[model samples]
Target: MTMLPIQTTATAPVATPVATSTGDPALPLELLELELSLDGFSGDEASFAEAVRQAADQVGGDFLFDLPASGLAEDCLRIAALRVPKGENGAPTIVFALLDAEGATIRVENPDETTKDLKRFADAFVDVLQRI
Candidate 1:
């Protein structure tokens, strides 16, 4: 299966630590999220997410695979910002999520309110697949 690249003129994704009141804080969740309506893809949403998880791992990405029995759809993938190095900007990149299907969406830990980061990520992921 070939995936077509999508171009977006949006801002970049940034990661920030989530404030915690307790001693043990949960993992940081992405701040910026973008929705995508893709064409020419028909499959189960969970399967799509698993494929992404595998692809990300193949590309040396720090990804968290979703549990098959979790029955969760939104936070399916938690990955590192590939284009941007982790802890490059002083703050550690938080775990990000990507959900793809006929309609897809990407979530990242960024303060910017633009789709640029998501666009870059999507492009990068496609580029990796093309190379492999």
Candidate 2:
């Protein structure tokens, strides 16, 4: 399997703020900040699951696919997994999703502690998003 390298920067946090497309100017506009890494699987849920497993191994982090609570399904338009490693200060949890036939998206949550390494992880996630 081919893997891509992601790098994060301190100046810019790994977040993509998207606005809702609802055309209600009077209502408060909501913004969602998503920090994700993305890749392409073989357009199959099973393939995506395997990719997540490999990514976990490569990152030395625990991997989970189609977590029940995540509401991912084979028939759904898209599906993904949020991989959370073990230990108190382990790697940030990542959410890997199949955006479409040609691409997948991985989102990473902030670590419990605000450390430089965590920041780098966030940056890496951002880099992944950009590449995707």
Decoy 2 TM-score against native:
0.33
Candidate closest to the true structure, highest lDDT: 2
Model 1 stretches with alpha carbons more than 4 Å out = 1-42, 65-92, 100-132
Q: Write down the lDDT that model 2 would get.
A: 0.37
| lDDT of candidate 1 over 1-132, digit per residue (tens) | 122334533242222223221322332221211111111223345455654444345433544333331223333432323322233343423233434222233333331223345436555665676699
For each candidate in turn, give its C-alpha RMSD to the true structure in angstroms.
Answer: 14.2, 15.7
- Top candidate by TM-score: 2
Inter-residue clash pairs, candidate 2:
8-123, 36-106, 36-107, 37-106
lDDT of 2 by residue, 1-132 (tens): 122334545543332322112332221111111222223233344465566556556655444334321223232334434444433465444433333332333333222232234335545765676698
lDDT of 1: 0.34
TM-score of each: 0.28, 0.33
